[model samples]
Target: MLISTSKSLFSSLIISTRNTSNLFIGKNVRLRNYHNKFPLAGIKVTVLKEPFNSQLIPKLFENFGAEITIFCDTSNIKKQSIDLNLTNSDFVKAEVFGTKVTPKKYIEAGEREIDLSVDGDLNVLKKYAIKSDIFINLENKRFGEIGFNPEEIIKLNPKLIFANISNFNQTNSKFVFVKENMNEEYLELLHQNSKTLFTLGEISCFTKILLTLFNKQNSGKGQILNLSISDSLLHLNRLTSPLLLSIPNAFDRFYLTKDKKVFSLCLPTINDQQKFLKNLNLTNSKEMSAKIAEFDLSELNMFLKGSLCVCIC
Candidate 1:
């Protein structure tokens, strides 16, 4: 599950009781919460790395038949345009904030027009308002320690670092996924043998093969796969592989992971696995056409990739 806001985590917990409610924590997509009270099914949501052209609430409610609330870290000052846009839908507002002294007292502040929060990522929740049932979170990195800039990366981590999230309780997003419940395999073998690595490819085959390896191994016991998986199908190959970015003049961070053995996921088009894995990392050098068609290509999109894809430089 890809719970976007740290603030909306609890109410998500209160609404239902299903193991599918596990939040997307970093690249691992590991399941940390086993005691959820929410019925975790039939809820699949994805957005926020990019914005939709229309209001998502009415559409989600129309499509999903539930209150499609949007919880965002408040990112802008003229949040009213967002508010005006939301007025037509079933969208309401809420906030996700953290107090200075305690990680124990995470609170959700709700206001009809504008949800409130002290930690100040209210806009993070708002970003989902377009096609969601609810709206939550208000932000500015200055307001809280964490918020995103025009760039999609997390801006700051003063109050909550990546490590802090492991300790913090947040709601898991609605996902069609299974939990990587802690097992002796990952635990016993994790004594430094696991390594994290990333690759960027204009050549999709390398990335495709890598993701397949991770999924087959359940995200690998020790290695981490950081992929800059792009939706650009026309360019079927990563004109440049991940290592190309290290050249100093390059731009854009590639997908990344902290663990060495576990592979971070990267599959294209969230849906239609066949189309996503079409090329499956193959190519003819001269004509740039796929030459080696050996692997079984039917199971392309059957395996849904993780909610988390960490980019590294």
Candidate 2:
């Protein structure tokens, strides 16, 4: 009788696993179909040299269904355009930025080919600028220096949104000298990492541009937006309290298990911390670490299931 009951339970588990697998497969098929109708459909965006030559910003616009026209100098036009194509590699590498992104297979089939053009001649930019709803310039040069005037473009298209990406706020007098003389070494020292400051700044700038676009849709207005890498780094630094330095391990956000696998722990509020301590019957992170060390990663995951403590392993 005992053997029969165990066999019955094992069979049920196998059936449940198969059902879950099929459900996920069906969901993925639905997601692939959903990309046919994107939120930014019919939006015309003109991108002039991506920030730090990362190619990520334009890809974001493409992913959301915008018609993208990317203009680069004669030297980089071909290379940048080729990089936009979806490759069959296991990971997508942003070679210039020194980062590898996780493969998102869903976007591969739906991506439209980008329109590339040489940006040296003012006539070409003027032709597209007049028709573009959104204009992004990350070249770090004034419009006049680039061969055209922003006022002329605005006059032609009053509802055009312009996003300027730079290393420092151009209008601020204090950062004017630094912006002109800034080099790779100075940037690395400022953020204590190479290229991370630019990456963060670009993402923040992209988010702000999207918010501005949302506002423009309702208000029927266009505006100029500016983002600086230095300002983005400063904003992030301000979030860390100076008093945190006095506490031991106050900044530790990850813990190790018996199997040597690391996982993140997030207790954002006092209530969350209290709930985590009560659920684990522990008073501090040290105790939590000791407790976690007793189990392998798989066992720890099972142990913490349905608990208030937010953990990612």
Candidate 3:
């Protein structure tokens, strides 16, 4: 199933299979090198969503050698293409030639846009589910609002790894939306908040999905993964800085260097602070800004290396 490395820091090996009945649990099998480079080769993935939403998921799967097929309606595809400035000729080429002749922009937007109407028959989705190893749903709609039944699809393909990304969890009816008729000021606020929420949500879902894939390798079973943007943001906030939860902007801040370059530094503990100050031959943190201003970004980077300071440029 799954083979992980020991704590010695050696390279780890992972082996996966659909049939575990013939697998030897603890016995060592002779290792052989194979020319195949892609870890997810032969894995079939089906994604149900517009091309604009959750583009990274399909790209990630494609990078790992998984065959990804995205199903969405024609209007959404046209809107996305228009928004991204993709020409009809290029879109047609991408559709006809697939990845072989796909432009970088088309790939970035999402590859091979299949037109499957959301109002279409459930049997169409079922056809894909029966052969797919992984199914990802990035539609903004609630589970009930989604045209097909997830349970029925899973029953058709027991080994399918189903993942759903929503604005909120299934139980919560509250949806994220701003009507076109809304005032500009109110719409702007909604847009900004939604952007931030979705960004954090995508990060959380990406991590959880990777972990779920690993779990499936170990257990040889499939499970449903439900991720909400708001919930993910809360979870991330808790894990990142629990003590500074009440204090706004308590985390690291960026500074402009003498050469106008930007960087962020963190000296969390007393020892780190002492080490940083000692390296700079300074007595207090009060001189940090002035001292940092004296050096160029490159010089500052070199100075922070062994001073127990975490610096990002």
Candidate 4:
């Protein structure tokens, strides 16, 4: 789930970003948070193409009345039109203000290759970006085409808050790349909580931008933030790792009462196991498990109710 911020912060913007793979699929990111805060009502923003995290940057800026200008290839525009179920013109109007000048026609004039990593590409984009307060680059696919160093682009306009989305943390030392990863090995811990994969990077990067946008820091200049999916999962797992290790053979058990399945790190003591066997009139571990499997749904529900299993650490 996408963590929420303040309501006053979201009201000014039309939230369009969402987490497509998690619970409540396709839910907008803005409907969740509300704390007393400032809004970006008048800031100007320019975004290049749409990436996985594309919905968030614009929504956050919109919360503060920020005027957004999105520049994407014609193919991307058509795809968005189909995805959002809106006409091309209608979609354009929904993203930008009426009075703001858009380079739609200018961009469509030629098949221009805009790569922010390249000095020439950066210069071309700068023409449209010079007038904006922030620049967000979501074109991770074209990141390899970056020719000039990121430091030079920051020198072009130090005041601007630039956010670039890339899986690798090598975009530039000046710009933070939130890394989102998807791996099969994490399935063990991931299945334990129905947790989605590689979403931590998106959440971390979004939080970083919010911190800077609220003037919580001196300036976003020269700051680089990396939020990788694996890194985020590691950070999250650290909280309960010690307690999990405290128990012997904690990873070996997968709780099963018939078809209903649950997991427990609770390793019953020898004394407790003996008592359970005697109470159930069972002689062996296999017999004990068979008795448990025969329990009715309601019986099982009451037996396992409450905090019978808690890690003190």
**lDDT against the true structure, each candidate:** 0.25, 0.52, 0.53, 0.44
lDDT of 4 by residue, 6-96 (tens): 3433444423334334545344222322223434545577766631223545565665456777765333222222334543444334332
Q: Write the per-residue lDDT of candidate 1 for residues 1-313, one digit (tens) a residue.
A: 2222211333343323244456444662323222233222223232221111112222322242232333322222223324333321122112111111211112223222223344334454334332221111212112134433322222221111110101011232111111221122222322221112111211232333223322333423222122221322112323424433222111121211222122223322223223333344422222111221232222221333442222222
TM-score of every prediction relative to native: 0.20, 0.47, 0.50, 0.41
TM-score: which candidate is best?
3
Per-residue lDDT of candidate 2, residues 198-305 (tens digit): 456566677778777777756767888776754654444335444322323322233445654434344444555565556667776556666765666666455445
Residue-wise C-alpha lDDT for candidate 3, range 1-313, written one tens digit per residue: 1112111111233544433468686763322221145555566888776433446556766765667887653333333323345454444444433432322353324444444454443456668877777888776554456456778777866767888776554432122221111211221223233444445557667667767766665676677888765466555544665542432221123344575343445444566567666766898766666676677777766766765443221
* Model 2 quality (TM-score): 0.47
Please give the lDDT score at residue 293 for candidate 2.
Answer: 58
Q: Give the distance in Å from residue 300's predicted Cα in candidate 3 to where it truly belongs.
A: 32
lDDT, residue 226, model 3: 82
User: Which candidate number has the best lDDT?
Assistant: 3
Worst 10 residues of 3 by lDDT: 1-10
Off by over 4 Å in 4: 1-38, 50-54, 73-122, 141-144, 168-197, 214-230, 239-313
Assess candidate 2 and give its lDDT.
0.52
Candidate structures ordered by TM-score, highest first: 3, 2, 4, 1
